[model samples]
Target: MAAENQHQVPPPPGLIASLAGLAKNCLHLLLSRLELAAIELTEVRDTLLQLSIVFAIAMLAAWFAIAFGTATLIYLCWEAMGWKILALLAGLFAVLAVALVLWGRSLVRQGKLGLSSTMAELKSDRDMLL
Candidate 1:
């Protein structure tokens, strides 16, 4: 009769304690998984940051190389070719510019230029604005 009464009563505190312990264990497992994920994410971010830094540095170095090469070429030409050659080159450049302008005018007369189409599109867009 006494054992039956005990069984009928609410289960002892031990079962409730065990349930709390199980909950804690589950929580700890979940937290550890989250920590692992965070660590991986941090590592990935660091790697990406490093790669971006390296790429920027490489671009900067390449730009420096290009600037140095252009300056060197100009210096060599000015020093070796003398001022007379430089003057002649400048005259040639002016002539080339004039020739290109005349050629462009001829092409416009032939209707080979796309500028009119572009200008029409621009005008249409401008009309829509008004």
Candidate 2:
């Protein structure tokens, strides 16, 4: 018991204090990154909502234009090319639609909708920690 009492000197203060400070700084960094992610999420939501509205409007206008233009073209080509014009135009529109769908899919696959800045910052933080 006396030997135990003699060995009761305190641990090094600097290491403990530094660990506490490091814990505090890590917590602060996590909180700031979370806040930034939240802000970016809100912005992304707003942007997606706006894009949905605009895409809806554009689709509506495009449908009307496609209908009128197709009818006019069919009328103009009916006398000369007859039914072949209709089949050709259909095939052409089908190819165009397929191309557009492929492009949109590629964009999706490329992660165009991801939170770039947040991901970059997280990667940098991870790199620094490692």
Candidate 3:
């Protein structure tokens, strides 16, 4: 029975050719996946770099505008106007500060603004639930 079921083996060339084809196909699949991953990584890197650069430029512009405006205002106030205007400016600032404090308190009472204590209380509640 064993002798009757015995089959002839394929030629060496045929086996080698099949193995080479399989290897080539596997290498192609591996390279395609690697190429896709590389492209996705490059796109992510580029997007992050662009976002960081834009944020930095915006911060720099904000700082420049603040410094320039403050300097211009001080120069106009001290050099252009006399010392008498300084007293009036101080009084105006005091009044504005008082007004802002009152307004902020009113908003807090109305629940329109969250003060530091309120924020802490909300955070504690969220933590407890979580």
Best by the lDDT measure: 2
lDDT of 2 at 46: 93
Q: How many clashing residue pairs, candidate 1?
A: 0
**Tens-place lDDT digits, model 1, residues 15-120:** 8899999789768755765565566667667867997799799879986985687567567788677676557666866896799799868966885323444455
Candidate 3 residue pairs in clash (backbone atoms < 3 Å): none
On residues 1-130, what C-alpha lDDT tens digit does candidate 3 reach at each position? 7765677565567788989997897687557655655666676578669977997998799769856865676678886677756577668668977997998688659843224444554466557648
* Winner by lDDT between candidate 3 and candidate 1: 1
Query: Which stretch of 10 consecutive residues in model 2 shows the poorest summed lDDT?
Result: 107-116
> Candidates' lDDT values, in order?
0.70, 0.93, 0.69
Q: How many clashing residue pairs are found in candidate 2?
A: 0
TM-score of 2: 0.78
Which number leads on TM-score? 2
Which pairs of residues collide in candidate 2? none
Clashing residue pairs in all predictions, respectively, total: 0, 0, 0
User: What TM-score against the true fold does each predicted structure earn?
Assistant: 0.36, 0.78, 0.36
Tens digits of per-residue lDDT for model 2 on 1-130? Answer: 9999899998767988999999999999999999989998998899899999999999999999989999999999999999998999899999989999999899789976788889999999999999
